[model samples]
Structures are given as C-alpha cells and as structure tokens.
Target: MKTKKPTQSAKQAAVRYLSRRDHAEQELQQKLLARGFEQEEVDEAVALCQDYNWLDDARFAERLLNNGIAKGWGLLRIRQEMAHKGIHEEVVSHLFEDDEFDWFEHAREIAQRKYGDSPMDTDKEKARRLRFMQSKGFDFEQVKYALDVDDDEY
Candidate 1:
C-alpha cells in the first residue's frame, strides 16, 4: 500500500472539510490540524482555497451574522458569537452599527412570545422573567419596555 503524497493528502483533506459546510480560513486550518495534517500541508491547502475565493473571513462573519439575525438573536449575543468564531472587531462593529440589529425589538418580541399579556401575577414570576430576559442579553430598559411592567411592580 502506497502512502498518499502530501499535496494530494492536503487537497483531499480540504475537500473533505469543505464538504461538511462553509468554513473560514482559520476554521478550516484548525480542522485540518486537528485531523493530523502537517503544518505546511494545512497552510498550502488554506492558501489554495483562499486563492480560489473559497475561504473568506469577512464573508463568513456576514453569513454568521445573517443566520443569527434570522434566528432572532440579539446584538450582544451575536457579537459574542462572532468574537468566539475569531471574527475581527471591526467587522463585528460594522454589523452592530446597523439598526436592524436592535436588541430592544428582539427582547420585546421574545418577551411577548414567552409570556403574553402579562400573565404573571406575583413579583417572583416577574423577577424570574426579568432575570431570564437579562440572561438572554437584554438590557434593563429593553426588558422593562418588553415586559411592560410598571415601576410599581418592582
């Protein structure tokens, strides 16, 4: 049995990696390394894909943000996720600048969907829901407006 050549192995690995889903260069490199590919081979594979426009950090960030937005995630959560995925601060900042990334509206919609028309009668449940909203990455103002609880309720 003959061993596969390094270049052929890298190309095969890259193709297998890309077959699963779209990946940024960094992500692809990490996957290749984890799969036991040598550094030089991984680098070559990443470079080749980049040359062909198959891997792009900016495009990856944009697609991730779009998918997150479609799933109703707030700006804060999305930003955290982007950072975790190795997306640069500048790209994340630009996405946050768009008004369509409003967390307040998302919070309102979420609150309404979970607990419609102020069904909670006691302070404990309100507090629980408030905590839930905060945990969901909503600010106090947004949660208050979303829950529609009067000041006296607190």
Candidate 2:
C-alpha cells in the first residue's frame, strides 16, 4: 500500500481552493499555509500549479479589474483591493493603462443614481455629495465633475 504523499495532498488542497476563484501566488501560498500545510508542501503545490498554468497573477488581476468595473468600483478602490490580494503594482498599472473607460462619466452616473439629476444647490449639499463620491473611491477631479457638472454640460 502506498502512503499519501505530502506534495500530492498540497496540490489537491490548492486545486480545491482555486476551484472557487482565481488567486494570486502569494495569496494562495498564504491560504495553504494558514490551512496547516507545511511551507515546503505549499511551495511544491504552488510550483506545480504555476507549471500547469493554473496559477497566474496577470490573469487574476485582469479578471479582478473587470469584475470591479462591473460592480461600479473606481480605479483607486480596485487598485487597493488588488494590492491586498498580492498583485503587483506593475500589473495593476499595465491593466489600467490599457483601459479606455471614462471614469468621470462612470462617477457621474453613480452620483446621479444615488443623489438625483438635480445639481447640488447648497454648499452643505455639495460637500455631502463630494464626501459620498470620495467614499466610493473617486479621485477629486472625478468627484468634482460628477457633483458640479450639469447634465447639459456633457
């Protein structure tokens, strides 16, 4: 009878975790380690996954960017989230550089949906709107355009 190999167990555990969603290499390693796997076993599993093209940080970043956009998240928030997942800044910058979506337009739409079509009439209201957009991760320019621009200005 053959004993269960540690590397095989590690690989199986990694695959199971990956089945639910894509994970960055560091993220996967940490998860496996947290699950009580030895560092050597986790390393072997990660290497095998990478060899099979099953673990790719670039692919994970791309998917994350797309998903964040679909969920109405701004670039700042998306980048921060990706960083938390162990994605490199180079990958995040590269992906964002190629994206042509009008962030201002998206911010405007989100603000309009949350507040209304009417322009902010008071300093207090404007401040409140600005805070809301900022909380949603929009930069100052995007938030200003969203809060200050009239529908006809577009």
Candidate 3:
C-alpha cells in the first residue's frame, strides 16, 4: 500500500502553535505529539512549518535572548531556558557569539537597581542577596562584581 500523507489537522495545529509565538521545531513537534497526533504527522507538520517559514528555532532563540536581557536575566539563565525549550547549542552560539557582551556589567546594573549604593550591612542580608543573584543565573565572579563584595565586605 502507498504511504499516507500527513493530515490537514496536523498542519492546522502546527500553524496554530506558530500563530501564537515562535516555537522551536522540536518543541513544536513535542507539543503536537503530546496532543495525541502521530509521530509521522508531527514530523510532516514540523517539516511543513519549516518550509513555510512558520517555525524558526534561530528566531525563537534570539527572541528568548532579547526578552531575557530585557527582564534582567543573566546569560546562564537565558541559555538554560533555551536549552529546556530544545533549542540546539549551535543556534544558541550563533546568537551569543563570544565575550563581546559584558555580563558583569549587566549583572552589576541589575544589582544596583535592586540594592542601590547602600551595601547590605549584615552577613545574613548579603547572603540572601547573593542567593537572589545566583537564582538570576549570574556566576560567582559576576555576582561578586555586581555586589562589590570584596573579602573585607563580608
């Protein structure tokens, strides 16, 4: 028997997902598959979506980066979100590139915006702020720079 083509509903679901926001190919496929669509159908729908320029991982990844930065999220946090969404490392690297961006400066701005010129007077408060910065995904060095935490400060 001849192979069956992907159904219209699969294509419709793919478009509907894309209509809301950009989705990575793998993410879209997972969504469709989770919706009870067959693997073959999801595969074809994803391929069609790519062909129609409706699904673009690079665009999605870039949007994530821009949005994360706008929200004062650190590079690590943004990259983790992208990876969770199934975006490839190559796609992420394409947008991030090298050390052209000053992560420490960005982290510093976020820290200053929240803590201002007044330093946390207690070790407890300082630890809390450091934990918050870590949750925001900045590395130790960046967090230290952001908080201006010299050894004597502790």
Candidate 4:
C-alpha cells in the first residue's frame, strides 16, 4: 500500500488556521512561518485567506476593538493591543477616530466604580491611581478626567 503525502496547499492550511481562530493576515502568515512553512507558502496562505475574506485586518480590528472596549479598556490600550495583533495603521486610525468621547465615558465609569464618588485627597493615593490608570492603557488626560482630578494635582 502506498501512503499519500499531505496535499499541503495554502488554502488547506488557511482553512485549518481559520478553523482554530480568527486571525489577521499578517498574524496568520507569522504563525505559518513559525510552523515551518516557507515565506512563499506563508504568503500564498495569507492570500488565500484574504481571497476568501476569512482573514481581514479591518474586521479583526473592529472585533478586537469591540471586545476590548466592552472589557473596559481605554483607547490607548485598545490601540496598542490592535497594533500588537498586526492591524494596519489605517485600520487602527479608523477605529479610534471620533471615539474619544466614548472612550472617556467608559474610563470614567470604570474609575468611578473602582474608586467612588469622592476623589482621593492624599497626593500619594492619587498618584497611585494615576499610575494604575496608565498601566491599564489610559492616556494622562483620560485618567485625569476619569478620576476627576486636575493634571497638576494628580
């Protein structure tokens, strides 16, 4: 009996990748490379996914942004995460455009729930909260607004 070699076409690999999870084209290409596929093979696989509209950067960015925002992340954090996920700059820009107010409201609500109606009076405590906000991906302005503290004060 003769054993048949795996017909490892790019489309087949792309289908496998999509079956596992949604992926940006660049991300899928990187994964394919890491899995021992050659550059040409990875490129072809990415093209296949794109042709099928199964791996779109814009769609990935939208989904990623929605998921992160729903989890209470600020714009800065969401942008960074989307960049890390290999989304193009244009896509990131589109997602964040005209979203400042929405993101601010989200940050404010998160801060209010986490802290309280009253602002922290102590400098050290306020500083700590500011740092925490930064770590959570908020810009200084958003953090100040959310915490209801002045820039000079916080």
Candidate 5:
C-alpha cells in the first residue's frame, strides 16, 4: 500500500496524546494510524515526539512500574500491563533491575489490606489465601511469604 507522506497534523495529534500522559512509541504510532494517519506519517509523528522527549517508552515503563507498586500489584501483573501498553521488554527489564524493591513485603501488605493479618486457623484458609495472592499475579514464593505458609504445610 502507498503510505502518505509525513504531515504536521500527525505530530500535533502525537503531542496532544503526549500532553495527557507519556506514551510508548508503539502505542502512539498505533493511535495515530488508527486515526487515519499513514504509516509514514505515524512514524514521523512518533519521531517528532521522541525528538522533543515527549514520548518515551522507558519513562512510560517506569511510571507504570511505580503505579503498579503503589497499587500493590505483583511483578507479573505489572509486566503484563506494561506489555499490553506496547512497552518494550528492555524498558520493562530495566525498571525491574532495581533490587531494592521488596516484592514480598508489598505482597504481604496487599494481603493484610485485603484479608487482614489474622492468623490462619485451618489449612483450607491458608490454601484459599494462597490462591487469592496467585490470582493477584504474585508468584508462589511471594504469596507464601505473604500468608506465612511454610513449605511443609502445602
């Protein structure tokens, strides 16, 4: 297909999108294309946004990571959300490279917020809590840590 040449209007649209929130380049490209922009126009618009530091996937990823952590989301859920928003794996990976994040403590906090810190009285209750954490996208170890379930208990 013959793509139309780049245009200023596409860049304007890109800026409008960026003014609302930082966007991954791929996400901005797809939005512009969906709005009837040609591929070349979308590419130019994306590049223009990048040139102005308006659209940056790494920034988007970092904000997403921080937001997810604030919302008590596990790494799995955060990663999935970043991917869905067209964030690159490299960007996502870099955000997770920080070892200071205590995912276990975060999971435990989420658990306490949702289920309280009451000690489990039954094996069934422990399993149910474990399943709930898993549903929230926490890994097995983190979930166990949140519920304080020992390996021998399962």
Candidate 6:
C-alpha cells in the first residue's frame, strides 16, 4: 500500500494569505490561482471568503487610503495605487469625496518638509523641485502651489 499526502484546500491557502494582511478580491484571486489551485476551486474559495466578509474591497480601500495619507502620499499617487490593487472605483471615489482632508494643504506640508522654507532661486532649482513633486504624484496645480507658497505662511 502507498501512503497518500493530504493536499491543502483552496480555502486553506486563501486563509493563510489573508492572515498576513487584507487583500483585494482580485488580488487574492490572482494569488490563489498563481499557487496552482484549480480555477473553479480558486473562484469558490474567493466567493466563500466574500460571503463570510473576510474579503471586503471597501475595507481594503479604506486601509490603503489611510496608509497612503499617513505616508504623505498625494491623491493621484494614492488613487493610482488603489486602482492597481483592484479596489473598486466607487470605493476609491467615496473615500476621497470627503472634504475633511485638504490635498493642497497636504502638498504644502510635504513640500516644506522636503525642500524647506527657502524659495527656489534658479530655474534649474525650480525645475528640480517641480520634478520631485511630480514624482510624488501631485498634479501641476498642487506642485505649483507647493513651490510658490510663502514661507511666512508656515
């Protein structure tokens, strides 16, 4: 007689992955599939997770948004990241629709911390600062506001 090995079920794999952190439905689904689980099994596992409220895109989006804000990320960057993670557009938009957080103010604070209170003197210096802000996922308007805000305002 040959000894048989017990294989891990889709639910088992999914639960293990979820233990580490929250994951978007699509992200979890992809991860489960990549691990060599059958497509139907992966789908059933994902559906079960969703039914049990173990997988919530809204919750994931909220956590991601809050984390990005804490990290001083601009709205554009945060939005892009959430989208890439497969968060629903409605969830992303709803989180950003609140008027409590001021993106412009956030941009100014980030700029002050990065480049200090001193104004850029040369075009080259200004360009460099602009590039930095752009790389941070701020739009041109926010970047301009950040670069031009008076030091006395701080």
**Cα RMSDs, all models:** 3.9, 5.4, 4.3, 4.3, 3.0, 5.3
User: What are the per-residue Cα lDDT tens digits for candidate 2 across 26-103?
Assistant: 999998877777899899999999999999999999998888877777778888889999998888888888789899
What's model 5's TM-score?
Answer: 0.89
* Alpha-carbon deviation at 7 in model 6, angstroms: 3.0
User: Can you give the lDDT of residue 41 in candidate 2?
Assistant: 89
State, as a TM-score between 0 and 1, how close model 2 is to the true structure: 0.85
lDDT of 5 by residue, 17-121 (tens): 899988888888888887778788788888888888888888888898898888878989989989999998888887778758888999999999998868789
**Comparing candidate 1 with candidate 5, which one achieves the higher lDDT?**
5
Cα distance off (Å), candidate 4, residue 81: 0.8
Q: Relative to the true structure, how large is the alpha-carbon lDDT of every model?
A: 0.77, 0.84, 0.88, 0.79, 0.85, 0.84
On the 0 to 100 scale, the lDDT of residue 127 in model 5 is 80
Instruction: Report the poorest 10 consecutive residues by lDDT, candidate 5.
Output: 1-10
lDDT of 1 by residue, 1-154 (tens): 4433445487678977777777877778877777677889899988888788777777888888788767656566767778877777887677566646566777899888788886787889989999988776677888888888777777
TM-score of each: 0.78, 0.85, 0.89, 0.86, 0.89, 0.87
Q: Of 1 and 3, which scores higher on TM-score?
A: 3
Cα lDDT for residue 121, model 4? 76
RMSD of 2: 5.4
Stretches of candidate 2 off by over 4 Å are 1-8, 149-154
lDDT of 2: 0.84
Q: Model 2, residue 121: what's the lDDT?
A: 76
CA displacement after TM-score superposition, residue 23 of candidate 6 (Å): 0.5
Candidate 2 backbone collisions, by pair:
none
Model 6 agreement with the true structure over 1-47: per-residue lDDT tens digits: 43233288889989888989999998998888777788899999999
Task: Please list the residue runs of candidate 3 whose C-alpha ends up more than 4 Å from where it truly belongs after superposition.
Answer: 1-8, 151-154
